[model samples]
Target: MKRLIATFVTAFLTCAAPVTAAELGDDGLHKTDWMRDTFKDLPEDLAEANAEGKRLLLIMEQRGCIYCDKMHAEVFPDPKVRQAIEENYFVVQLNLHGDIEITDFDGETLSEKAAARKWGILFTPTMIFLPEEVPEGATAAQAAVATMPGAFGKGTTFDLLTWVAEQRYLTDPEEDFQRYHARMIVERNNGNTE
Candidate 1:
């Protein structure tokens, strides 16, 4: 009975503790086990994400952006946030100034920087959440269900990801992201966070 109680305590603590994160890559990006290293093709990545039962997430960041640093160091390291991303999303990182080739959902191929410009991504640490079924000839930015610009606190970030994963944007279009996040904040303060 003592051992059983100890096991229960351990399990609870493990579940309650914040998750540690992976090391930063040489590219100055946090490298998680869940991030995919692909050819930067949106359609192919979408197909792969679908096959893995995950949503395709495109995250843009620069090498020296402090907001990116904050996200990798603070927000993403939270266990609940990390778990939500790892379990429900296949992330692909894009360097804001990189010259690497990227194929867009609309079949346009361009460098990472060019794509960023085309997509009107003017901020570092922008997270673009794509819908499962993108219409033909739509650009990735055009097909995105939601876009998170700049770094946010852990709670907001987690709630945004959760909203996207649950497809709340589609079903609760009237609620919107702001309303959902506002409700989440209230719920958290009320002790039902999650």
Candidate 2:
């Protein structure tokens, strides 16, 4: 009985504790185990993500961006957020000024920087969540179900991940993210954000 209690306590603490992240890369980007080192082809990546039953996530970050640093150091390291990304997302990281070539879903191939410009990604730490079924001839940006720009708190980030993973944007179009987030805030705080 004592051993049983110890095991239960260990499980509880493991689930409750925040996760510490690894050192950032020379590019100043977080190298998480969940991130996929893919060929950067949107169509192929989407197909692979679907095969693995995961949502395709394109995250844009730049070198020495403090916002990206904050997300890596604080937001992404949260156990819930980390678990959400690892379990539900097939993350592809794109450097804002990287020279690596990328192939868009629309069949347009360009450098990472060019694609960022084309997609109108003006902020570091922008996370673009794609729908399972992307429309033919649509760019990745055009086919994104939701876009998260800038660093956010752990709750908001986790909620957004849940919202996208659950495909709330499609199933309930009337309930926009703002409304969903409001409802989520109430629920998360037990109806009292104060």
Candidate 3:
């Protein structure tokens, strides 16, 4: 009887534990399997993403950021978000304040911090989504199709990824992301029973 109780208690606790989406790096940032460890060169990264038949996604985050933590723990850990990111995006993580060198697409070389400043990134958890075809001599910030500036809930994040992956921004200009997200929210709510 004692053995059965112990086994049941352990199983209950295990079932209730949250899933971990990624591990933490020494840089104090969450490291996921979906993220690439590239040379931080925008052009090269884009090319690599293209070669892999994936979209280039630049994720800018800072250390000890509560929002970033929330994204890592709450958002990214969700299976839908993780699978969408892994399957459709070649993610690259950049520190908002790090000094690592990065070569922008326009042939300008700058540190990650400089690039963030130039791109007007003032917040943690900024996601920059690039188009497949970029014009010559255009910087990454100049060519980005969409940018998410903060952490969002699972459904929003999933919709954003799906929208970008489907290239709906170009095809459906009348139904913008906000409208699409609202529609999706209603559809999801209608499908839920509890």
How many angstroms is residue 114 displaced in model 1 relative to the true structure, after the best TM-score fit?
Answer: 0.6
Residues 16-108 of candidate 1 have per-residue lDDT tens digits of: 974445566787766777778999999999999999999999999888788887888789879999899999999999988999899999999
- Whole-model lDDT for model 1 versus the true structure? 0.91
Which pairs of residues clash in candidate 3, taking residues 3 or more apart in a chain or in different chains? none
Clashes of each: 0, 0, 0
Compute the lDDT of residue 178 as modeled in candidate 2: 87
Whose lDDT is higher: candidate 1's or candidate 3's?
Answer: 3
Candidate 3 local lDDT, residue 87: 92
Instruction: Pull out the clashing pairs in model 2.
Output: none
Count of clashing pairs, candidate 2: 0
Root-mean-square deviation per candidate: 7.1, 6.9, 3.2
Model 2, poorest ten-residue lDDT window? Answer: 17-26
The sequence of per-residue lDDT tens digits that candidate 2 reaches over residues 79-166 is 9999999999999999989889999999999999999999999999999999988899999899999999999999899999999999
Q: Write down the lDDT of every candidate, Cα atoms only.
A: 0.91, 0.91, 0.92
Per-residue lDDT of 1-194 in model 3, one digit per residue for the tens? 99999999999998898545667798888898888999998889999999999999999999888889889989997999999999999999999999999999899999999999999999999999999988999988889988999999999999999999999999999989999898888888996635
TM-scores for candidates 1 onward, in order: 0.86, 0.87, 0.88
What is candidate 1's CA lDDT for residue 12? 100
Instruction: Rank all candidate structures by their lDDT, best first, as comma-separated numbers.
Output: 3, 2, 1
